[model samples]
Target: MALYRGTGSGRLSRGLLLLLWVTLGSKLCPTGAIVQGANTSLAVPQNWTAHESATPDNKSQLPQFTLDDHYWLFAHFCWINFTIWMNNVTGAQLCDWRIISRPYSYLQYCLESAAEKLKFGYPNRIADDYIFKSHYIYFLNCTQDHPVLLDPPEDMLLALIIAPICLIPFLVTLVVCKSKDGKTQS
Candidate 1:
């Protein structure tokens, strides 16, 4: 869901720049200018009917979701992420990333931590939640000069679909960057 409008030379340059902007923008900003992290304690409404509504803090043990619920949870997760991305239109209406990054990050953090049971560990959900948030900022910064085409998946494939799509872009970017470096040296 990380698509952006870029300003560069050709279509390839603009695409390469935007591809980088959406993919690496989260990692590039240590201050997290793009998206803020979520507060896992309790930022979302506790309604069971809504998107993964349940606190991880129980009296006896840590929060845990039923395995049967995972499929449904995953479905909702994908749906909500898609909804947010769809609303994330880019260009002239784009907002400043510095000003409006944290809330999205927070929402993302809350969602992943609650749904995926991740409190403190590797950032496996970075691509899932963080990237979406990054794309949000990128979209907000869009202009007439930089129109964008964002393709977000809308199916039950969830991680199966997401993992491969994310990797393809990274691999392509890697090869492109290496080739650019090689040409520069020549």
Candidate 2:
């Protein structure tokens, strides 16, 4: 389909084309700042898993998550792009987009707060295998912030159910072929 019609002489058409190009083109072009931010070191604190296994006496020292503003922006862009890419590939919205601009500390606080809620407030609402790996989770270093109130279907159960359905036709065909061979030979 033609984006510009006729001789493309109209100011309105030119303005519209320019606007569209700017809006769509910016996403394709990443800035050097974001690239530099991507290289920022994320050193995991010593005994980082202490939060998971700490006793009440030693529960005060939880690992701190720190990221510069530029890195945080990179994370945000990565997350948004990932969601968009996945939605396009799946032809459906597999995950919701998070597009709020905030500091990395705020993001950490939000994830930690949610983790506390999932741990204590509504434990049943947390999904099983909720800590599965993903780019958003890894880049944010928020593995403990598992999906809440989102109980996805069981992968193993689905695979088990589909396996037999897939094998039955092939097995039946093999058995019928063997029977036909036996009868013909006899």
Candidate 3:
């Protein structure tokens, strides 16, 4: 039986092939693999101001962050990253944990504060008890202007997804040509 026939049938075949390719492609190349060197930076948009600056003097007074809080934030970050990758969103999104510098050190400061509060194996009291959680939320809400840079492993995995899509045309051509050759031989 012939695979592709008239133009209408050929279109239908291509569409079905595309659908199959996507389905198989996703199964073959899953996302969120957590490959190392998937480094991305978070950028604070202009006109956005942090509620308070974390300074050396106040480092001893920041509230503590619980294990659950850390876990929740980690999950949130993963979900956001997954969404960005899945949607292939253009431009950068917020990734506060990736920010390691001062002035915009939302995540770094929060973690340092958490560590400080846990000194001597005991949680310390602070002026604002909810400081850690608040800052965590704030950083989560920050925006990233730069795109996520995928490392070699991640690049190859992503290429696996695209390579098949790109080969669709060549694959269909090969199939059609084979059918034509068979007909001629017959």
Candidate 4:
């Protein structure tokens, strides 16, 4: 039977096709491009004053966050530079483990402080810490005023479960498309 009828059944077929296209589009969406050669000072928001204004080595004293705005951001940076590619460390070498570790530890400390403030519910430390430091790393990494999404444990678990499922369907689509094209040509 025809997959796309010309009536109500056709509408259902169209909807499914549309949904498949949407899912595929979302999966293929590209991230923002790196700003090149444009006086790119680090884009940390000015309000995030929680960090220690010391040398890079002294960054350990920062009240850094654990997710540090998600380990993925750092991993993304790493892959953009020197992972499974040509061996020169040219692009962005800012994500060295030593550099990324301290501020994260500091964010943990800050989070603990916020948690203590939040434990009482309303008018407390969480709001108090919101001055600058609380969202420092988050704003630093995000583009424009968009909120940074931290990867919580659940996200990792969900990704682990969903990645293969998404891939299998895409692979199946490719095979089916190829089969249809082959049959039509022959």
Candidate 1 clashing pairs, residues 3+ apart or interchain: 36-101, 36-102, 36-105, 37-106, 38-106, 91-142, 91-143, 94-140, 94-141, 95-140
lDDT of 1: 0.42
In the range 39-63, model 4's lDDT, one tens digit per residue, is 2212222222333354447866443
Instruction: Give, for candidate 2, the lowest lDDT window spanning 10 residues.
Output: 122-131
Candidate order by TM-score, decreasing, is 1, 3, 4, 2
What clash pairs does model 4 have? 48-132, 63-106, 63-107, 64-103, 64-106, 64-107, 65-107
Q: What's the TM for model 3?
A: 0.20
Residue range 1-186, candidate 2, lDDT tens digits: 122223424533643464344223323222231221122322322222223444547746443333332233233333333232233332122232352223233433433454454343322122111212233433343334465666456997789889999999999999888998666663
Quote each prediction's TM-score.
Answer: 0.25, 0.17, 0.20, 0.18
TM-score of 2: 0.17
Using lDDT as the yardstick, the better of models 1 and 4 is 1
State the local distance difference test value for candidate 4: 0.39
lDDT measured at residue 142 in model 1 versus the true structure, 0 to 100 = 55
Best candidate according to lDDT: 1
Q: Cα RMSDs of all predictions? A: 24.3, 21.6, 29.0, 30.3
Q: What local lDDT does model 3 show for residue 67? A: 51
Runs in model 1 lying further than 4 Å from the true structure: 1-90, 93-95, 115-122, 125-186
